[model samples]
Target: MKRRPRRSVPALLSALVLLAACVLVAVSAIQRILGERAWIDYDTVAATLHNLHWTDLATAVAGSLLALAGVVLLLAAIVPGTATVLPLAGRFDSGVARGGYRTALRTAAAGVDGVSTARVRLGRRRIKVRIDTTRTRPDGLAETVRTAVADRLDRIGPATSPAVKVRVRAPRRTT
Candidate 1:
């Protein structure tokens, strides 16, 4: 089974805060049970609770907010993180890091003659290559770039081969 990615920074920080709160509560409970000086004052807490009106709108709003926070934290922990790497075809588990595939595609496109520059974007189901060429006839340039990018992707043998879409643009003339 593939391991889930790490949680986001905010999720991790929230978890840490929750852990610390639990530890503090546990320590306080132990101290109170052992007749030692507890960090929290039980008398004050009881008095505050008795004074609060449970039916008040503020109490209801506070309770709702607390419930919503718990739900958000639970969702963060249960949901799988976003995928940042594309899986490669191989006997063992292998993946190409983000931007690696783009770089490879760009290099392959740039290797073609007359190509001044190449920009590539790799998506889940499509690969878009934008090429700036100095060649007069750009009619056939798109197909050529597409073929080159397709061949490069085939060589890499990723789990899913994205369809290649090539766009040829004329190079800007400099005075």
Candidate 2:
């Protein structure tokens, strides 16, 4: 299936700012070495661009390329597998969907007898279900909850089995 890219405006802006800053810093250092006559300053260079006194244009071009490279690297580091900035429509709802699935599993597990509490976690690759039973002899409690979870999820999709885990703690003793 073709999945769309997820876009983040703030992240893109931050990358652009970082790129500009890097380019400015590189240009300044190069100018300082080449003396004040160098047209590295943004305003001076823009007004007297026709001067072309030295090969500073080459330095500027190199700096711009370096800045572009930095932006590409930043995007790659932040966006996982994507090397370039990909435009996306809106944020993804995977978190919400996973939460809903987890909630369903918890509710179903809690419905079982002697189930004290159920903590369900659905991960990107798998689903983990933890159930604390009220009795020492949990017996078929784990199997029951596992079956319940599988059945509930069957309507939507199939899950990797043995993923549902039920932990039975010792029964609480009366004071």
Candidate 3:
């Protein structure tokens, strides 16, 4: 089964804000209908709004902030979140989580001979591998790591195979 990306945080926040405003407005209206004191003094608010001028600094700032919030909410609604899982090639039954995939790639890199430690950062189309070794002249180590990572990737069989990039460094002592 395919996995969907998580919802945007900004979008959720905007929805919550709108819901709160609606609830507040409804409660005030209900209180007014009951002939009781409303939560908000509408008469006072109307008078204040009538006296407020566009040239006022407070009015300008409030308008700018509202416009900015609208733009942010619009962008949040339009942009899609990053995928959580990558689908496997020819397999509709399962997919791999990004964390698990990165861990597997790190294991493949570290399994190479002379690799003291391995670090991996994975992207949709790029796999970056960094390895530390003890040997001063770590010749062919990068290629070996790349090959091992590629082999592992083949076994996992992601729908899209990311290009493997390997960087090997020999440990050094600073005087």
Best prediction by TM-score: 3
- Please identify which of the two predictions, 1 or 3, would achieve the higher lDDT against the true structure: 3
TM-score against truth, every candidate: 0.59, 0.46, 0.74
- The list of candidate 1 runs beyond 4 A from truth reads 1-4, 19-51, 112-119, 130-138, 167-175
lDDT (CA) per prediction: 0.83, 0.64, 0.86
What's the CA error at residue 129 for candidate 3, in Å?
1.5
The list of candidate 2 runs beyond 4 A from truth reads 1-96, 158-163, 170-175
Q: In candidate 1, which residue pairs clash?
A: none
Winner on TM-score between 2 and 3 is 3
Q: Residue 3 CA error for candidate 1 (Å)?
A: 5.7
Q: What are the per-residue Cα lDDT tens digits for candidate 3 across 95-138?
A: 98988988999998988889999999876689899999998788
**Candidate 3 error regions (>4 Å):** 15-47, 91-93, 173-175
